[model samples]
Target: MYTISDYLLDLLNYLNVKDVLGVPGDYNLSFLDHITRRSDMKWRGNMNELNAAYMADGYARQNGMAVLVTTFGVGELSAVNGLSGSQAEKVPVLEIVGTPTLAAQYDQKLIHHSLGDGNFEHFQNVHKELGFKVEAITKDDAISEINQVVKYVYENKQPGYLALPVDLTEMPVNPIFKQLIPSLFRNKNEPHDHLQNIEAISNQLKNSHHPILIIGEDVQRFHLQDVVRNFIINNDIPFADMIESKGIIDETLPQFIGTYNGSLSKDLTNQLINKSDLILLLGAILTDANTGGFTQSFNSQNTIDINAKRINFYSKIINYNEQNGFVNLIKIISQTSLSQSFPKGPHDSINNKLPVPSDKPITQDFYTSAMSNFIQSDDTVIAEQGTSLFALEQIKFPANVKFICQPLWSSIGFSFPATLGSQLANPKRRNVLSIGEGSLLMTIQEMGFAVKYDLKPIIFVIDNHGYSVERVIHGMHEPYNDVPALNYSLIPEAFGAKKNQYNYFDVRTEKELLMAMKSIENNSSQLSIVRVSMAASDAPEDLKEFGKIIAKQNKG
Candidate 1:
């Protein structure tokens, strides 16, 4: 009685996917029934395919892997935006599109979701451009194709798309229990080669008087926290992160310097980073956002940048083949001893403490500091790509926490849907989302899914009456940058929240915000949403600088 659908669910379960995020479509109804009825996989229906894809992305980031199922054509196209964000962020999400039957395809019949031109492979070809390993699955190679796709996703930390035909759902297939290792990473399991390169790096660190390290997002992707922590603590090297990799290292550590966003960093941070003798840049994603619009300055000759697949030491580029990767490189770097010590940032500095509440309106400065205290250890903080992210850069997170954002992709409404995925991935942890009103307007429907599932995530909606980020970048007084005023506190109720299930607050002043924070603390078991109103003209200093830089670049 076992079917291919059952086998597919089993494989997903093997990959530690307990729930699937997607919307049900008629084309995929048969497979949806199998998922909804199955005990191994729980189906969480989203309001739309885009939100489903974003939720799956958030889940993948937290759980290491995730799945998104959608109907072919329209559903698949709608979910592509989310999948593209995941692909850009290097998250592993398996995208399954339940397509028309093989018979329909063979006969070149026009389907409801098709283009009517009798071309079945057009969508798959379109997906190929988005960095997805796309495959149109058939009965004969279904199991093998699934296995291969899953492995590619896990090993490469990228999205994979599979167009699953409806007719193959009932076909019996053996569930492969093989691990999904990266097929393209030939050097993943290989031993270290070029001991000379290791020697050169070790000697460089040992001889340097002030060798500093820079941590980045790949450390979290590769799960190298312990190795990174030990390397920093054992060698007494000061470390800083690019904005995208904010919480990759233990921020509470004494040796942890603040994040560097090129010229956007504070004066002290910029000085220290630029003055480094030997800079060991590990797992960095050097995007314009991460580099503060390409303003970050480092001596190329003094920098040794090591990523998952390659090493850039000085002017030389050594690619990882069947010999070396981060595994071997990290080992060599960890064992090396520095000859001299570098001055670390103040260890006893409690500069980021929350401010005492007053009757004044809640400014971005005050809100950032207050939130530092509101956030607890082990909480996952998700910020939208604008003012929320820029303000949070000033706060120092506690231990065992996560910070999720799409700085490079710059998606506006990603945080709200991502919160659902993050909470589902780590149900026990407290999940908090910080997003502006404009961004929230895009994916607010996903809140209904949260209420239906009884999931709790503290959400902060910064109400500035419009697109605050856009206004700063350009068109400060323009109508296009202004969003309709929303009563954000009513969102949960509108989304069908039960009585006392969620605590809602609307705070315009510092005193009100402080009271709201206390209320949220007391109602930890319930979902909470706080709406804080700020001046439409106000923005973080760093954001203003970024806007100017971006505006200037656009003009040139």
Candidate 2:
């Protein structure tokens, strides 16, 4: 007989979820068994629940939607931070939590993973606070609830939580439920005022002399990059991308000016955006990091903000019922005669010239320039927050390269496990992970999972002593900023990687770092870790300024 577990897995399979990611807990074992029995879905176990959640977040960023399974209470709580990050970034991840039997929960029986108080709903409530559409699945409502929750997560691009009782996995389900649910795509019915709003926007674009288009993370989340690119090319409109949405469109396009980070943006980019008579913000969230600590200053009177559910034309708001409303609106706008001429010529792209190697110790500026030269087209770069992210901001990515980071959540250790999940999502692309030493220490065990799967990702461990970002903010010489040094060269072997499976390098000077990068380029098939040592005091200039702003804000 088909079980609820089977039905759920089948539905997820319809959404292109080929691999299920989680850590096995006692409560989740049976569900995991069901996952393993299916040929369409493979179970990829992680080192811990938090890492699993992070992996799911990364997988969702690449794979449209992701499913993460964890046990009730302890396991789910451990994964909460990662889920919060996904929620803040508007990523679609469905978290399935296996709880104690229905009978036990109803009787208030104290379970192993539950709080001693016997309240099973506490954890689900916590997820509710994090903005997940939560539900408790029962035999009567399992089919409908699963479909609703999954659809909500996918269409809204937000996290969803489902509590699955341990005994419910074995419950028999009707054969009729075995058929996949209908596709979640909604029928495109134009709103009544869509034509008027589209025409108004077109007129504004045509009348303006200086117009700028800014795309954000939501465009990538909603799979509208191609449509946005087409609009840019069709209109000959100059465009800038937010830091959070970097690499969503090809950066090499001459129409592409540069990344706009509020006041932190390049001088030319900032000047053009500030001077624009009309600004079109497509799916941009305008978060603190995206706006350079809330420094972006565009008048609503001169801006048209397009979001998933609604559109703000100048100061007026228009809501649409179609799920693909944003897509339709952009297409309609693109087809109209929006611009008679290009507003401005594109600024020159960054010069990614490779630095000459010398006997000098490697600095942040030199490292950023070298890395810019090292990154090729189609590589997926996972940059951890702090130094790694700041340095990556200076690099110019080639076409089709995907850049993944958690700037909104700003979680330190997220990129390591995320690298693994991103690689699993699209194994064809080369995954390069750049993480600081302090961040690596939090989720270093995930390296074992990488070795277990025999996945090859170039890992760069920046050994800048410790929490350099924090140091630059307030405590430059405080003991709290320091982290213990590790023998990074031996990490692979300790994580069960054979010599053939990986390569390890320890470099302090410019020549050694260059040699290690060259060697990894030559042998790109195996996993390689390069631990480059730098002075603890060295940091990117932008990071230092950002830290000052944060420090002032914190004091206030």
Candidate 3:
């Protein structure tokens, strides 16, 4: 005789959710108590609802799935942005919002968070834009609704929304639910055209002369990295990933080449991908930001784009119902007689050689080189939007390193709180965050959450004095783009960091930056912060080109 909340927690446990990220509110306090009672699940409280959603996203990206709890109206609305981003990225997250009691909603009572019109269904419609599955749980259908939404999230790799009334939080549910949820585990809606699709793809590859594999965010979101890696290595195929899929494959692998970002890619990368006779795009999303503002020149007729449930060959759309999905397709293709060799990708013959350290001050070029050498294997890189996102793209990541950034959504303040969630998800791996001062200020309160949880992610704050990316876009010297310079090194103390618990460094020169890196190496336990100061107008080379494209697009 478990309560609905307990049943929900158990369902989440079956989905591998070890922790729930959320902020507390009066409506959700009852549900929070149940979260406290569950021995297998822990509640990670955040300072705000948006941060909670980002934390849940990071957790889901690492742990397969994540649940986030928030209150009705205000709380749920604040979390909508994060949930939408997860949907755009095709990550699986369950957003559970605690609402007023059933009676209050029935009577249409005016609530504190409502718009005074007594309409409670507005937010429900709003969240529908995020994913296909959404359920407003009731006393009668609590178990079934929770089960359905969770199953849909797992099957589809998209976020799900559930609004639980306060009255139903601890209400006991049917004992049959325990057995039902476990039984439904085997009932996922898998693709059903595995054999035929694999044969088709194999035949196509056999006919092609130059074939290349392009991976994207879907591979990571669907947890097919190992299978995809095996396929690439066994087939001896040259492969590349989109900007958002950094580190999906080990960059150190011989067949693994540089990232392909349409025109923004290196000359060699563009030449290899653009001139190829056949392109097998696996779960790749060709967004404007990742494709250099729609400058990609690949012919759709020659591309075989494979998504979760559908395959696109040229202009034809084939919906394949495959039970094993891309895994089986890859397995069959591995044994096929496709050519095992192709022209070397751009990774070789590319000069990533760093120039001599400039004596003047820290620049984006030097920073990228410093970071390339500083990052090690098993490190998760959390990159904030704007300059931090585009700048870090040039760095060479070590094996097993993950690069997390919101390039498509371009949401600021995401990486700051995301560090908290990713660290908690993978506690053994070191988390390194690169964020600008403007972006950091948006969710700086989450720094306290990191301190409270004893998370030691190395944070790099690029102190450019303002929104450098914005300046590049339109207002180069406009005062509207400028922001005040605040001392970032002292923020740890303000966030309640104990004496030995944290270390801070402010660097304006290459010498100072290297010294800070050495100090961080020596003091590994402390949460270290290294502030890199740079010119206000300067930005990464790719970022500069992107801004120009965006500015032109806006004008048109």
Please name the candidate that would achieve the greatest TM-score relative to the true structure: 2
User: Cα lDDT for residue 385, model 1?
Assistant: 88
Q: Highest lDDT among the candidates is held by which one? A: 2
Query: How far is 36's C-alpha from truth in model 2 (Å)?
Result: 1.2
TM-score of each: 0.95, 0.96, 0.95
Per residue, candidate 2 scores C-alpha lDDT tens digits across 1-556 of 8899988888888889998988888888999999999888889998899999899988888789999999888899999999999998888999999999989988999668878787888888898887899988997888888888988898889999988888999888887765546544545465644887888888888898989889888888888888888878887888888777888988888778888877777778888888888889988877777787888868787899997768888778889866667777877787766537765655544446676789999999878887888888999999999999888875657999898999889888999989999988888899988899999999999989899988899999999889998998999999999999999888889999998999889898999999999999999999999998899999988788888888989998
RMSD of each: 2.4, 1.7, 2.1
State in Å the error of residue 206, model 3: 1.4
Error of 1 at 12 (Å): 1.5
Name the runs in model 1 displaced over 4 angstroms.
175-189, 347-351
Residue 102, model 3: lDDT of 88
Candidate 1 backbone collisions, by pair: none
Global lDDT of each candidate: 0.84, 0.86, 0.83
Clash-forming residue pairs, model 3: 191-321, 191-322, 191-323, 192-321, 192-322, 193-321, 193-322
Candidate 3 lDDT tens digits, 1-556: 5788888888888878888999888888999998888788888899999999888888887778988999999999999999888888887889899888889888999988888888888888889865548898987777778878998898778899999998888798776777777677674555455566678888888777788889888788767788878877877788887788989988778887678777888777788887788999888888888999999878787899887767787767877554556555554565675564677654732225655665669988788878877788999998988888887775657899998888887788888888888889888888889999988888899989988989998999999988888998999988988777777767888888887898889899987887888788777787989999999887989899999999999999
lDDT of 1: 0.84
TM-score of model 3 (CA atoms): 0.95
